[model samples]
Target: METKKCTSRQSHFAKKRYILYDVNPLEGFNLRRDVYVRIATFLKRLNAEDKQYQWILVLPPWGPLYHWQSNHIGSQIQLKWGMFFDIESLRKYIPVMEMHEFISDYPVNNGKTTIDIIYQLRNDKNMYETGIFKEKNMIVSCSNGPVSYKIIHDQQYTGFFWGYSNISSYDLQCLIFHGTILNLKNNFNPNLYRSIMFDHMEIPLHYTYGSTEYWEARRSMRYNSILYNIAYNFTSKYINLMEHMDLICDLKNNQGKNLSQKPPQTPVTHGFDLTVNGIAFIVNFLDHFTETYLVIIDAHTKWPKVLNLKKIMEAYGLLEKFKCLLARYDSPIHVVTDGGPQLSSASSLSIEASSSCV
Candidate 1:
């Protein structure tokens, strides 16, 4: 099980490393999400225990799922992570990078990025047949393993790689693993390989299945704002209309008895509408400084307040500014925003944000 060490030029002084992974191609979307929680917990522990290196998780792309039966949407392969989940919200739990970003940042040669090694995970057949299991992470021979990967040329192994043809690995090894996710850290050699991939990540179980960290990771996986808007729009357009129609029919049958003497309640406090400028301004070293404005509105009064900033802020800074804005009126119970990255990340602190509701 010897793998030739492939070191990066910056490995001499680099303190950052990437962990890329994938589930079995047959695994469904829900199971893939569970694997993510396990990986997030593992990465968190890796960063805490190993102070010398910072570990970042590279998210696998989605598409061509066996369950996705719709034929009109065309090919769903190679879809980015942001299209389904809130990427910024994911970062609140663990550092994550999209596949495209990883490909761009990773060193490439001849239009291909070679992974240092690929650990092909397989089940322990003996334990499954005998109904007896023991924790293990043993390197087995790949000669009789699954034939998902093959050596293409120049000793580079090629496989699905999430449908990307440009990605390959220098070596492949079969691992018979039966343990928690954290146990896989024993396979890492940060000094030799800056990047590694796990082909069958779904085999490992979570370190703590129902602990606080597990729940935190699960909550951070919020659906994209677009999905929320679609659901809200459907409810507003169809469900509300059906309710109104039922009310009209009731009034026709019951007459004035069904009429209410009081009006609907209007939220006076704890209602906010947030938005950022549509465009950004970049200025030279002169008096005209770069600026972006954040606008906050009172949902009940339709009143607006503008906050100026030298530049667009990230999640942490945006959260601070949002807290100051909320203080002027009171603690926010519900807030609405357009679901942009910064606003969505900030609102995720206490409430979920969308165009219609928070």
Candidate 2:
């Protein structure tokens, strides 16, 4: 009887500890968000690309002053920041709050202090930057550029929703969106949730985490390592990547709410039609390399002609290819393309050929 009583008591205490850990295991440590903000702010002082992340400068074991001066300042940091890393590495690099006691073993109060670096992240500036993406030569710069611009709106909601010291605005928003999705999954009202998410949150149209557009965008971002390197959300970005857009966001138009409209009728033709499709450069086979393919098929005859081009079928390239085909084969009675810039511009080419040749 005594053994059973003791075991029950131990089990009760164990459950309480688990609950405490879930709430927060290290809450007693008194870690201030000010420390994180200061560290990130100081990194930005470097005046380099996407200052949120900068290479930690270290002393060269064998280098003398003259050798260091011979190389470009950024060369030391080159290929060091890397495409993938975490916040822990950053914390070890620098701390916003300095705990080390001043050396000289005496409180002289003469030389520079770490206090000069503690900027308190004033004016609601984000302690960490994330999400914004860029491309080409300025990709990293472009991704980090929007961090400051988003601070005002994103931080306001993040603080209002869940103002834990360690949580940054970008993360808080991800959680909010994540929870909203879970709530909907559990049968929460779609209309009300969308009202808050769209009108209130102002997340751009078709950018919702579960939306088709969001997944398409994410797939594009992931396939290109350059852009993926700058993305901040990896886990939460995939929270609902497979789910379809929630019906709530498919806001219906009420402009014709009380009016009746007739269904449109179309006339079917039995004429020859040309389906011209150009596969744009889906992915560069190698860095700085890409190709475009053009396909022309007869809708009725079922005959297909494929052209493999060495160049990305740009507007001019499409015009040249389409002209060559028309010059050789029967003039396509009508042409249709999936909005390829090259193929669309062929409209003029078609008119010219009609007037001069066919």
Candidate 3:
């Protein structure tokens, strides 16, 4: 649990190259300390023999960062050195496994693998405060040092197939490969394919209300076709798709039942004014006022859209007018009010009036 920091100067004979390994502590089998010790011993032997290679084993947050740091001591040890790298353990972080899957499936090869951790970036306010990360993917260099690179064409197709946004997919893929080479140059041994695919199978499909329309339309087109059957075959295994299909069935059943219900509510009158805060309060003594008048306008209608008060006053006026008129006249009166300056100043008075009444 102790925090440890290790600083090493650039070797005179050793190029500033490293290989980075992204080790997930929460993953399958945890490597024992003894195993790492043996690896370190082997790496020391390699360094002593002048094999200009360095290997850094990234440990999960749960793993011992200090143990690795303490094991490799002194400045004489050059060429090759083995160290434990545990970002997750240090930060108590959970890497975005799903995004890594999509990137892993991305068909690209630039000698480095880039995992689009955009989903993780979304949860970080500082990383995406402007919403740019939501619309674009972030590419972190998985490599140890800086490197230039390009993605393989097939990987780009994979990104498109996975429905990654264009800008995000391309940039993220490039960043992954570039990061990999950079990490290698920094003397860290990062497993590009393994790290990229860490949480692939468990990655969830992007779901949202906007996607509902697309899914519904797709389901409708496939309902009676061979394509439908094919889709069913593929989607039946996924719980989300199955649940969506059940929802569609329920919706269809509800629609059928609704066809036999009472007719929909319809407003009989067009426009009137209600002035709890308007001139209507001052003009309440107008004997012409009838309870059945449906439309009620307010004075604040001229205000900006964001400041427009709720039409509660108008609604209350209409209801009270209807009750009083029905009791007194035993009939309905279509209430009409002057299209006052405030109401007329705004657009779509007819729509607003109708909506308020209902």
TM-score of each: 0.67, 0.17, 0.16
User: How well is each residue in 1-358 modelled by candidate 2, as lDDT tens digits?
Assistant: 3443233223322211100001111221112122222223323232243233222322101212222454654442212122222222233333211112111211222231111000011111221254433211111232322232124342222221111222112111111122221121222122211111111111111224444333222221111223222221341244432132111001111121211111123111211111111111111111134655555542222234566666745766656665665554423322322223223222343423333232
* Per-prediction backbone clash count: 0, 0, 40
Candidate numbers, best lDDT first, in rank order: 1, 3, 2
User: Which residues of candidate 1, in runs, are more than 4 Å off?
Assistant: 1-5, 240-331, 335-358
In model 3, which regions exceed 4 Å deviation?
1-17, 22-30, 51-358
Superior candidate under lDDT, 1 versus 3: 1
Give me candidate 1's TM-score against the actual structure.
Answer: 0.67
What is the clash count of model 2? 0
The worst-scoring run of ten residues by lDDT in candidate 1 lies at: 246-255
List model 1 lDDT by residue over 124-168, tens digit each: 999989999999899998987675799985878998888999998
lDDT of each: 0.65, 0.24, 0.25
Q: For candidate 3, which ten residues in a row score worst on lDDT?
A: 246-255
